[model samples]
Target: MPRPASDKRERLTEAAITLARAHGLEATTLAAIATEAGVAQGSVYYYFKTKADVAQAVADGVAESLASARSTLGPEPTDALVGFLGAYVDDAAAICAHGSLLATASAGTGSDRAHREAIDWLAERFGDLGFAAEAARARAVHLLAGIEGGAALAHALNDLSPLEREATHLGRWVANASA
Candidate 1:
């Protein structure tokens, strides 16, 4: 019996994300994803027309997970912001250490739209925290850059302490900004 389309697509997506996270986006081939997913190589094309599509799906998945995690913090604006930033930093750092997949995704073709949408989502989250529009935009950008920077630095140095410290500081900053 054939697997459900949604299940197959999800498996393919998970495989792609795992591959990208282990070997970087450039190494995330449809064949490899299919193999990891335990499906025929051609099956990947049925769900994702191109490698870019797979990458975009992965990015969207990460964004969705982050959004869900953020939602669990309740409706308190400051708490939500702090929790979101902390979760984002931890998630990004983990992904980066996996193979810097997020960085590779950001550099890939057709990634601009996904990146912009992710930023917009974050900005809206900040805006919901009662920040002025410009301030929310700035905070979103700052938080993202700080997380990315911290992750890269930690990776380069083979250290997790710096990333943890930076994430904590950023969380405090978000809380203060929201206050």
Candidate 2:
């Protein structure tokens, strides 16, 4: 029996993200991604038309997690924001490490805007916690910058402590902003 299309697409995007992170986007090729994904080279085109398209899917995957995180939070906005903070902190290594590659490709449809879309999603959630619209957006951007900055540093130094600390601080900041 044939595997599901969604599963194949998911695998391809994930492979792309992982490869992009490890090898750098410029070094990661469609052929390489197909090999990494364990799909035939031609099969890759069935799901994604270009590397940017696959990159965009990767972004959407990240954003989907944010949406899922938001849904899991209870009715209280402040607590939810804190939950998001913790989640981000936990995922800091991945996010920070992939920061450069992902950001550089922020031009495609779907997942290309995933990073900004994720931020926007978080900002909206922040608003739910009683912050003014602008303030909520500012807080979201602030958290993003700090976490990604830490990620970038961690990526450079081969360490995760910076990302962890930034994630923690941002969580606190989000809590305080909501209070």
lDDT (0-100) at residue 117 of candidate 2?
71
Local distance difference test values of all predictions, in order: 0.70, 0.73
Per-residue lDDT tens digits for candidate 1, residues 1-179, read 99554689888888887787667778788899999999997889888998778878777665555556656767666676677656655665454453256556655544544445546766787898777788888878887777667777777787776677777998888767742
Worst 10 contiguous positions by lDDT, candidate 2: 105-114
RMSD of each: 3.3, 3.2
TM-scores for all candidates: the values are 0.79, 0.78
Overall local distance difference test of candidate 1: 0.70
Q: List the candidate 2 regions with Cα displacement exceeding 4 Å.
A: 1-6, 107-112
Error of 2 at 51 (Å): 2.9
Residue-level lDDT tens digits of model 2 in 1-179: 99654688878888887787677766778899899999999988888887777767766765565567668877776777677666656776566655776665554543445567757876887788777889888877887677778889978888888877877787777766732
